[model samples]
Target chain A: MPNINTLWRTYQNLIISAAILLFCAIGFITAVFPAVEKIQSLLSDTQQLTDDTKALTAKLTVLNALDESSLRQQLSAVISAVPTDKSLPTVFSTIEGLAAQSGVSVVSVDIEGDTALATASAAKQTPEEKMLGTRTIPFSATIEGTLDAIQHFIALAPQVRRLLRIRTFAITFPSDAKPVRISLEMDAFYQPSPTSLGKTGAAIVTLSDAEQSVISKVSQLPQVSGADMSLPPPLMGQMKPNPFAP
Target chain B: MSTSEINLLKRSGNTLRTLTDLEDKLRVIAWWSLVALLAAGIILGTAFFYLSSRSDQLQSQSAQLGRQIDAQLVKEGILTSLKQRADVAKNALDAARPWGNLFPILSMIALPTQLKSISIDESAHVRLTMILGSVDDAVTVVTNMIALSGQHTIRAPQLISFVIKADGTVQMGVSFIPTL
Candidate 1:
């Protein structure tokens, strides 16, 4: 009976020692490993954020150094040539005026519908379009004039207020030395406002000198005036009385 | 001494030695276990404290950087439209091909040769068919075209053909692709 008691005591001691080791191991796993892993994850995220901040700071510094007014003026000049709206009437009038100046008589003016333009605009808004933001309208005209007048009109078409491309030029001279009948197919481009792009976050960029020169050329193109360029009046229902008005 | 007394002394000495050894072993085991438990506690506490403090510092830094980025973005908003406008303008200009500018080069080359016709395709490839008064004029046309290729405005001016007609006049054909 004494031997049995001694054996039981030894077993208890062994079990107690095992319990102490298990407790230490659990403490290391629950406290030490988790803390270390969290710290590592935090350090990685901090490093990534630091890199992003540095890049953005450098871009901001460069942008701050640029001449804001000059950039605005240049940008305005570019926008002037390619107005936000299509302004079809203005383009038509401008072409007629140019043709008249060149001594060509317009027999017929055909303006195509905006269906193709809508499709192209839709395509441009897609992700596949990437950086393309301009849309073009296609139209045709038939004019009658002398050979010299037709040639002069062709030369003056490019210098008009609205951009024009002479896609197809066909001339027919009558057998009896009558005036020449000329047919022209042209395309004009315009910009859609940035508001159509939804909410695009600010992007920083630098303009090269060559790009500035191109902007200067676009600005030098003649300006167009039409109803599309005008701003809408204040809403009649929402208008309040002006206190300062006489 | 008597034999029985000697034997009894030996037995007591052996038992006393065994008890003393057992007590020493128990003391050593207790000390080691205590030392191990204390070391583990200290290590876990130090690690947790250090890691949490460092994490707090890093989080604070990250917040500061985020605020700075937001401020910069706010400042950049004023120029966003202008930049967008300029980008569209630049793209428009890049898309245009300055085909009229090549006319002068053609005239320059045509005046020396008996130029018949010059036609340009939609892709801006120019085909020139000219009558040369002599073999020397054909050579001059070919050489001048080769030299024109050096200009940045044109690419790959190839002399397609040079043939002598029955009338002894040389007919030369040249094709050129324009780079705008």
Candidate 2:
């Protein structure tokens, strides 16, 4: 450090040094750090806002073009078209009925659901939950029937819940049958599996404390003699966190 | 004795003359040392001035930078808060995209009254926690869930956990693996 005394025998140097130190102290607090943080925050906020605005604007534009109810129906149709449910049994029964009605014999049903794969599939299908891995439970059924029966069953497939998707389908037959003696190998997806009451008390897919307490409490409640399983999961997701709040 | 006395007399006379000259040389050297002192001081002062001038320039530049930084920070802070608000709104809107049919079924769980809360994470997993009004409720809820899951034809087993909370809240995590 250069001493003020060395520079001059005058008081001017002392005043100058004091003023400089004061300026530095003020600048240190008031100007330097805040400026850097502001610049960085500005850039980040810009990017973030841009993304948010894009999403908001997109929603707004959509809302402008279509009514909310119709838009929701459109959205549901798009979402439910994929195999989101794991309850392939319902679909199997539906197909079986169609096959039997058409005079076909029913055979073994097979299932293969890779939740990890479903999650990946959801990522491709939905944009928001890309990081939140999607889950899928897949099942396949092999029904042996006549060509006419298989064709009838396939024709009735459109009546299934929109979530059902035909992953794979094939046909085969025994030598004794006529030219169209057919065995149908159909792979279909159920919507997401229903929340279950298992040996374990868990129903929803969360470890959050709030959910667990509710689960524990509900386990004690008497089942309403009979409640349709299909109607519960969707309601469970929507109820105002409490129904039958004892 | 005679030889020693003679040598002492001769050496003593020469030693006095040499001492006189040496004192004179010492004075001369002492006189020149002042000039060296003055020169040393001048060199040190000049170096001090050069260093101080550089320091002043650097400090000025730093102050300027500090001012600039402060300005940027103000701009960034405003924008960041705005963006965060916008994001929350956007997420709320996104959530509206799902079908309402899925939520009601999940809610029919008939959770015990003692359970204080319900929350759902981004993965559609429901969390139910209760201050155990009674352990029976917990057990009943468990049984129903299992039965329902089977009936529902659930593919991936939902994850369920129960934590014995201090407040008697039996904490549970139910992984509802929704198809979508």
Query: What are the per-residue Cα lDDT tens digits for candidate 1 across A1-246?
Result: 976776565455545555665665675577656855766676676666556556655665665676755755655565555666566776687677777688989888787655445334453443311444566566888888876677677676665456666655555545465677877776666765543221222346676666666666776776533323432221222223584776
Native contacts, share recovered per candidate? 0.14, 0.00
Best by TM-score: 1
The Cα local distance difference test for each model comes to: 0.61, 0.41
Question: What lDDT score is found at residue B45 in candidate 1?
Answer: 62
Alpha carbon lDDT at A148, candidate 1: 64
iRMSD per model?
6.6, 21.2
lDDT of 2 by residue, B3-88 (tens): 86672324376775775565555544444544444464465456455555545555554455444433333222222222222232
Worst 10 residues of 1 chain A by lDDT: A230-239
Docking class of 2: incorrect
Model 2 spans with C-alpha error above 4 angstroms: A1-66, A75-83, A107-147, A150-181, A190-246, B1-180
Q: What are the root-mean-square deviations of the candidates from the true structure over C-alphas?
A: 9.6, 25.9
| Cα lDDT tens digits for candidate 1, B1-180 | 878766232447787677556656655665576576677667656755766676567657656654654444423433455556566665655555554455567655655237554555556677778888888878877777767777655687888888998988898888888664
TM-score of 2: 0.27
Q: Candidate 1, chain A: TM-score?
A: 0.65
